[model samples]
Target chain A: MKELSLNILDIAMNSVGAGAKNIAIALDEDDDSLRIVIEDDGCGMTKEQVEKLSDPFYTTRTTRKVGLGVPLFKLAAEQTGGSLDIRSVPVSESEKEHGTKVTAVFNKKHIDHTPLGDLVSTMVTLIQGNPDIDFLFLHTVNGKSVRLSTAEMRKELGDVPLSNGEVLNWIKEYLTEQYKEIERL
Target chain B: MKDKVALREEGSAATRIVVGMATCGIAAGARPVLNTFVEEVSKAGLLDKVMVTQTGCIGICQYEPVVEVYTPSGKVTYVKVTPEKAKRIVEEHIKGGKVITEYTIGNK
Candidate 1:
């Protein structure tokens, strides 16, 4: 993907497809590298699934489209002399806690490093489609941070859906303002 | 734009336009299609009547940037949708209630 945000969006969709009720996207950035950790409380994948994720062909051959998102992310990271790590626990009825966690570390100073695009739009699109799901986004640049949690919003909103045009607009503004605020830091 | 109170009372929008937003679709430019639908639908004052949303790819890699329109009757799947086509869809199929067969998946 041209933009890191697009890669994040694509990967997040996998979490959503996995029936995740709660998804957390965290970006920890500094002068050296940008680390993205996307954790999901979904019906996790098996060991085989996790192992096969890096191979582009294995994913595309399967019907579910595991190939496109992960491979692109791995390529993007590897191009910058960084790496992608994936850990998953297969869904087990006996175990209540099971999900997937993906981490991609990118060398910020590398010439091939893909820049983070409009992440605010990515967040809006995710919330706009899946209002029922809880999405928590946190970005920490140096020491300053910007965060949003739909779970917190639901407490204040009562019956108001996140998909509401008004609410989505507010989220867009909130994130955009936070991004601008981060730039001043 | 409807407030929280009015949006809750009326329930969700009656019609839905679902854009495929997976890697395949996004790579093929689904984002513009989605934004265009949302913009044109709102521009036509049809937000109350129609809602533009997104979903993961539905396994159609070749015919990506797919959009599906759902109404009272059924769904009409449009393939390889662009920003311009999204606007026409809102004006003709959505607001005008005339389906554009040429852009549909079955056009082949």
Candidate 2:
């Protein structure tokens, strides 16, 4: 992906494919590094599936093989002297604890670090397709942070789908405002 | 897919344009194509007739950024679409009621 946010969307889609009812994506950025964590209470992968995550990372994401979800994200991180990790617990191990968490740390100072692209669009696109689930997004830059939760929006909108044009506009505006405030601080 | 079926239960429009948005699709520039389709549909006042939506990989990673348009006749898949082509699709296919056969998957 050209931006780290696109990678986040790709991996989050994997969570949705796993039948996750709740998904959380967070970004923590400091002076030297940016950390992205996407955690989902989905049907986790088996140990065998989890073990496949360590395949060698590539330098170029686009020309790499198609249909792969992880190696590309791993490449985005590792190219910047960063790392990626995945922890999954299958339902057979413990039904209550079955989920997957992907943590990717990017060395922001590195020249190869990909920029964080339009996250509002990414979130809106995700919600537009899957309005039935809950998505929680939190981004922290320096000490300031912004948070958005579809669960709370659902509480307010009742039966309205997030894909509704007006609702999506509201979401974009809301996040834009929050981001502006965060950046101004 | 189950997702499209669920979406249809709400109120199926006369036409729908679905964009592929999996890892491969996004890396291949699907987002801009998707946004353009949505914008063009709304711009041409065809929002009531055309529904713009997205889906995960359709197992055609080689043709990343695939777009599927479902009209009353049937579904037509367009491969390797870009924002520019997406505009013409909205204008010719959706608005003009003429299928752009050159851009369809069958063209190749």
Candidate 3:
């Protein structure tokens, strides 16, 4: 909640919980606004469920009473003169593909907006935690862009585990370097 | 829970400390707990010796902010771990090579 990356991580966990094998997370930051869009090929919610998601008390989990991920994210975006949108198509729809998409837009210069935080760590953690899940991370800052995909990495890695400390360290460094390159562009 | 399996395979490190970072765990304030562990481990010059990482869910949300320490011998699960407790864990359990009984799951 403190950082945009943390909120992204939190929402991605929900995607994982929804049985998403492929999750695409995109962050677009420019002079005007910072927008994050997370789209997952997971078991999507029904219209009713999507409607109830804005409620702080609404949660599918049986463990605790409330689910704050959606509401908190919505609040964060709203505070920054932005908005949150969630779209989901049910798995039962034969004609339509089943998935969920969460988009949050925050004003770039908003005083209340939190920093991005350790985005490299967040991405590495997600990839390390769920190696089987394919994650595509695209970050575009002021029109300069960089993209990282686990599916591609997995093909290159072959037998080596993604969670391997060496590989994780490499990922962190790779992201940092890529961001620097993008920033320079 | 399933994520831990992938991490378990990366067994090259001498020690592995897993902090729960799932929604439940994070809501219970696991970020600070994780940050503390990473800071302490690095401060102690145990970067190569200890691998501090995170997992999604541990299945027990009630005992959130859960931390699991995997030594070469076995694994110890600690629940309700705070940043303060995380430092003590790094010092006593990780450095001293002794599990802090008071912080172990079900004990606290």
Candidate 4:
């Protein structure tokens, strides 16, 4: 609960690191349910790799092998009376691919969760900093949806580096504004 | 607490150094680099000249321990930073206008 956003950031970073050109993130909140989904078009993993991805000690990257990201995501969802699903498909026929899509669903009204502000901030931070990967986000409340595309924001900002203080500050303000609209519900 | 608004209004003239301090950065020795910058800045009696802050992941994990310097005109990103390089940055780049060519991503 405390670090749900951090977990999300870590997962998204993995996608970008996998050479994904496009990433999609969705959060749908209704009176009874909340669904979170992250999909990336990166190099897909083999069945064995997917099986080991959540093992907490398996990773192919040069980074540390303590694979806690997916495990943490799964734990967070399960703890909230939810479930997680991960699917991967290979990019090539001969070579085993490693692209992955993860989805977690929760009964929002029942789960003890962190504030939405933190989640949005984490998402914004991830999206702003990674210009090479495009992010698509959709948030739904009571059947109505508010969608945001990082590509659109990038266009508006005119290639401003996400790490630039001005850009980060602007992203924070944008997230704050969007959350305010959500709160009004 | 100084709100982000107040911090922003003060602008780069306020002289803040933001170090990428996430787990990735820390694993690459960003803590020591950050510490060196802070120590050097204080030792030079330039505490008022700069404010040091830490930020989470910047998405360039391959280039961990990135440091950013913001001035009145623009921002400069120094990638794969190190403690020794950080001290040199404070002594040369911050204190003087000349950027340390060796420590920059472009130079590398």
On lDDT, the candidate that comes out on top is 1
| Model 2 lDDT per residue over B1-108, tens place | 113212224456889999998777989988778878866776686655788887877778888789999999999999989999999999899888898988888887
C-alpha RMSD for every candidate: 2.8, 5.0, 5.3, 10.1
Tens digits of per-residue lDDT, candidate 1, A1-185, equal 77898899889988998889999999999999999999998888888788888877775544375766898999999999999999888687326788889999999999999999888878887887789999999999997998999999998887887876677778989999998999997
What local lDDT does model 1 show for residue A113?
99
Q: What is the Cα-based lDDT of residue A114 in candidate 3?
A: 77
Question: Per-residue lDDT tens digits of candidate 3, residues B1-108?
Answer: 223223334446789999988777876878768766766775686766788877767589899889999998899999999999999999999999989999998686
> Model 3 misses residue B35 by how many Å?
7.7
- Give the winner by DockQ: 1 or 4: 1
lDDT value, residue A168 of candidate 1: 77
Better of 1 and 3 by DockQ: 1
The residue-by-residue lDDT of candidate 4 on A1-185, one tens digit each, is 25555556667766776678788888787777778888888876667677877676665455442256687778778876888888988676324444779898876666465434356666555654465567887777776666667777667655454434445556657766876887787
- Candidate 4: stretches off by over 4 Å: A59-66, A94-98, A111-117, B1-108
Q: Candidate 3, clashing residue pairs?
A: none
What DockQ does predicted model 2 obtain?
0.33
Model 3 segments more than 4 A misplaced: A60-66, B1-18, B27-64, B70-96, B101-108
Can you write out model 2's per-residue Cα lDDT over A77-119, one digit (the tens) per residue? 9999999999998888888989999999999999999999989
DockQ of each candidate, alpha-carbon based: 0.42, 0.33, 0.23, 0.07
Per-model CA lDDT versus the true structure: 0.85, 0.83, 0.82, 0.68
Best of the two (2, 4) by DockQ: 2
State each candidate's chain A TM-score: 0.95, 0.92, 0.93, 0.83
